[model samples]
Target: MTQSPAIPLPPPAERRRLREAQSLTQAQVAERVGVGRDTVRAWEAGRTTPRGRKAQTYASLLAAASATAHEVTLRQADPTAPLTPLTPAQAFDALYAFCAPALVRQAYLLTGRRELARESVERAFQLAWHRWPEVAVDPDPAGWVRATVYECALSPWHRFRARHRHPEAPPADPADRALLAVLLRLPPPYRRTLLLYDGVGLGLPETAAETEASTPATANRLLHAREAVAARLPDLADPALLSRRLAEVAAHERLRAARPPVVRAGSERRARNWTHAAIAFTVALIGATTFTLHTAPTQYNPPVAPGATVQGVPPRAAPGALSRAELDLRTKLQRAATNGPERLTPDAR
Candidate 1:
């Protein structure tokens, strides 16, 4: 097969400036290019150059961005010139169209589930659509979406979810089934490394960075994974042959990605739903707070304690009962005291 067309790139410094001028992040560029953010950073830093298909894609993106900027400049210079810029939806659709089909196929290779592959691809694109501002000028929008797809397709969490609890039917072809089984046997990290390096045609450094491993470690994983594959399928011993076989396996699957408009509309609908939910939650919280404020007690009324005797004070003694002599004098006074003051008074002290 003929190689993709490659073009001369500007000096590394200028290349970075061109991307920066477009307000594109290194991470976005890397995502589109199917490499790690750090790989793009390395490209900008002049530590490396993009190669093969990735190089061609990178060049095309830069050139297109540069051309657009020039168009904008010319429009600004001559206000009457009709200005055209890619709308977010249009840009998103382009990105989805370019990446979705291949992503679905790749995802199937990873999960060996056609439905899951399609779902993962759609989910990834949905996320990209949600973060269009970031994805729009991303140097590698495809890569960004691809990473999400890979994560979604290979997530262990999916196994626990109801829909994905049981394993899907294996491929009809024994060889395809066996290959998938073997791929699944390898650890996720090793499997991912092999796919990116061999199947996806990523450079060693790019693969290592994307996999979040050091170059040496990535190399080790690749070696071990390849060794396992070669030991199992001796005929596909060569790396190129192995890569080709992987492609063949992926191509054999008839998975179809959701259409661009459907994906875009779904993304919008999902975002809208989330926004409405958030607003509802906020309103509920505000209402609850208001209700509490209005219904709460207005003043503090201290509780009254039961009465108790005074501490440290003695009780007064009760008077003795009236004596007999006092009673006799009281009787006499009652009978004689009406007319005489002397009679009312007692004679004895």
Candidate 2:
């Protein structure tokens, strides 16, 4: 692979000016450039200049951001511009510009390819743009976007394509590459935990949520990942130092995510209409099924033919009556018995 051309370093004052113009804080710049806030401050104060690849990234970010005003930070850049109230599009533009580099870096760490990382970040930002109203009101929009990027980077869509893509090349530094190879061989969840916690600098809870793991599970994964790496590199066995080393190596290369194209109001309206239509169709289908079950006609047993034998039950018996002659005889016999008692009394008289 060809080496990337070295970027010319801008003047310290110019760097500070471009950064302030874009309304970026030293901490924000530091995070994007993968350095400490004090380092950025020192750069601005002329106490130091970023060296090596760090200088290249710092210079490139300033050079790119100088060309356009970020919609979200316009008010910060110019207090009197009356642009404090920003539209969703404007707000998204600002957020994308500010967070894209770091998000891409994190994604690259996950996927091990610059282009793939850029693609994931761009997709995440586009999703954020579509749901900008919700994203803008969120307490941590950057976290929300970062989480989306994590999902995108780990998507099943990349599963097959990844097999065809060139694998991550080992660095010229044998020791470093050996460690990286070991890390790369770890399970996906373990590697993701290490990257988010140590590489991307997210907290435990944040990393857990991004990886969709519980806090305890995330902690376990991190522990396991650390142990695995330490097992391979015993000399750097201290967890803290190991974490820092991995972080530095993971963030070595970063590609800035481009601002995604905005959706027009009409297109959004159409999309919403389609969503509502789908919901209505589903509800109607369920209602139809319920009605069919509840109102379905039941079948009755067939009537028996005139001489046909009945099944399962016996037939009723015929009714009977006593004869008149028999009734008369029964009355006479009763009368005779009563009379006989009187006759016997006469004989005695």
Candidate 3:
């Protein structure tokens, strides 16, 4: 006899969205799913996926959540409905609350640093809040934010940070520590691809789309990553088991995300600050340009010559016939030819 097909679970972000839409908390969902709260958190965050009977149970829960959310949405859409649509802030907050926790864990998996992971997710969300118009209209806002977080977390520039120059402490579990060490040894691209594909349970096409790589390239990276991991730990030969293990290594209990309200408030505050700074910079720039236009000389101007003493001029003699007159008379006497005294006297007159 042929077996029935398995139920397809929604993406991690969508799972969280459905649960949130129904106003269900992680603990509540865990109670219903017969799993620990942390396990539910891991599943929602994309750090891990449940398998076999548990997978079926989880899928069922998500399906019920989706149905409930749909009913609520339908009721709200009626013309005579009393419900109000979400405000921009409400939507932003909803997206943040739904995904930030999982993003933090995913980032921690990628970088193996709790602080950096938390910081990356916060910064990404703040940026999303800043560009709310674009993010709001996006087909997959969660994916947009996740991409931003990945970029920030995996940035090569982090190497230059003094604090990040040294490694943080390793995980408490020897297996987790060993797994993390091996994962870190893989090149960043391969590591990221592996996390998104194997760890996150994303299909090849979805993983490729998220990683911004071609299907062939993503597949190649995943294969190489698997080979590398298997070389060290042959027990994780199965892709499904590898994904689960990856999730555990990345989602340490120590990595806690900030409260949703805090993250939302911070994002709004950051956006306001950015707006204020841009305004200030623009005003300053205009003022600087205006000052330049007003104060700066318009045309070339040659410098004026300084005064100097006149050469070849005699000093003033006390008004004896005016000094120039006396000098002229002495010059005339020296030039006159020496004639008879009487003739000289008549001629001098």
- In order, candidate lDDTs are 0.78, 0.68, 0.77
Give per-candidate clash totals. 10, 0, 0
TM per model?
0.65, 0.53, 0.65
For candidate 3, the lDDT comes to 0.77
lDDT of 2: 0.68
Residues 1-349 of candidate 3: C-alpha lDDT, one tens digit per residue: 1111111456778989988988989999898878999999998887766654455466656755665675577576785876655667767766665567768878887898989999999889888887899998876676688889999999999999999999999899999888888988999999888887666556788779888899999999999999999999898989867766765665554777777667778988887888999999999999999999999999989899998778988655775464677789887887774542545245554
Clashing pairs in 3: none
lDDT (10s digit) by residue, model 2, range 34-78: 999999988877666554456547755774565444543565677
Compare candidates 2 and 3 on lDDT and give the better one.
3
Number of residue pairs clashing in candidate 2, backbone atoms closer than 3 angstroms, sequence gap of 3 or more or interchain: 0
Off by over 4 Å in 1: 1-83, 298-349
